[model samples]
Target: MKAAWLITIAPFAACEPVPTAERFIPDYRGVETMLLADDLVQFNVSMTNALSARDVENYAECAAAGYTLIRGWGFARHLRTNVDEEAGVWTADAVYTISPALPRGISTIDAEVVSAACAEKGIPTV
Candidate 1:
């Protein structure tokens, strides 16, 4: 019975030990600038009339996935136009601002992926 218990515990004993303060040091230099901000950031998002809810969901998802430092309230506008007249037609738009930083070691492919994901959600790239 003792032998069986030892055998069962042997594998668990081989697990690595948890790290301590001495072994793990926090790095603050990389985040110092972001910790201090004086101005608000903004962005503009515009979409076609056919925009769907999925697009908005995707935009929010992308924003969450990215490295956003700050965000601000957004404004939107809707316009109407006549088919025959191009000059008099008013335009519709939406504006929102978010300050995001590129994570260290982020590749171009990562950016493209994020952009595409946002586009899929209906968030236009600025």
Candidate 2:
């Protein structure tokens, strides 16, 4: 009985422990804002070590929110967002419309609220 116990303990001791995965941290690059029309706006953002396209998209959204606030608007509606990755740099092209009232769409965002949330998350906004 002692030998059996010793054999079992020896096998367990020889086994190696599993390695833990490292945490992922993204590096934000920069943002460029462009006014396509009177109420139409565009945001171009780039970043490295992005986990996914959603990260860049959120960056663009934050920029739009900040811009809307700067333009004295209360709300914005998301029109579209195109994401691309090249040589480890992620880029996003996003478009939005600004208005004083809630836009007629489900993708509308409250500029003040989104801007505050972006600031709290340490994300840069235009």
Candidate 3:
């Protein structure tokens, strides 16, 4: 009978592997910040299924800008960023020097302005 077969299949259903949704990124995914010194800070950002390296790098930059502003600094000098991709997750680890003015290099950013732009773009910051 149909009812008998339905009951038999119901027990077998629990043994089946559940399908996981494939996504470009998880909800509420973003960056984390750490301060190594008064002027030096680190940002690590990770996202699932990002398609481009630029997106990962931008995440770190956004974190750096927001971190600099929250520390009461107006400028940030990019130190370095290490990017990696594994499976479907992309990660960028970056460091920056926070200051009141450009650090005499080509790698300076305005914290207030950049952070506002990052916020407008929906990137998370500290």
Candidate 4:
């Protein structure tokens, strides 16, 4: 009797909704970039739904590469990235240094190549 009662109660329990394919793509607009200085720039990307750090980082890199090219540069080097979550919104604030030639840094990308890829993917830039 107790076993049957437990099974009946289990059916009535409130359960969280399982994640679906839609959740994988957060309600994120594209990337936003700001020119803080001639060589220094800031990038921000945010999503309404829950997202992982990797998603935000990907958004930032896409933005930086495209922005560098948009500014008539050929390379971009990562400076820093800040991640935060507020009231369900996840945000990543990233900074980068852009240059005509490859910057003297380990973390750098060929802006032309990356930006072209980003454009093909329909990612926005500043």
Candidate 3 stretches greater than 4 Å from native: 1-28
Model 1, residue 116: C-alpha shift (Å): 4.8
Instruction: For candidate 1, list the clashing residue pairs, or say none.
Output: 42-97, 43-96, 43-97, 55-121, 55-122
The regions of model 4 sitting more than 4 angstroms off are: 1-14, 119-123
Supply the global lDDT for candidate 1.
0.33
Model 2 ranges with Cα > 4 A deviation = 1-23
| Clash count list over all predictions | 5, 0, 0, 0
TM-scores, all candidates, are 0.22, 0.80, 0.74, 0.77
What's the distance in Å from true for residue 58, model 4? Answer: 1.0
Over 50-115, each residue of candidate 1 has an lDDT whose tens digit, in order, gives 134333333333432242322322221111111121232212222222233333332212434565
lDDT of each: 0.33, 0.91, 0.83, 0.80
Give residue 89's lDDT in candidate 3 (0 to 100). 78
lDDT, candidate 3, residue 48?
65
lDDT at residue 71 of model 3 (Cα atoms): 76
Top TM-score prediction, candidate number = 2
Candidate with maximal lDDT: 2
lDDT of 4 by residue, 61-124 (tens): 8888877877788999999999888887788999999999999989998987877776776555
Better of 3 and 4 by lDDT: 3
Q: What clash count does candidate 2 reach?
A: 0
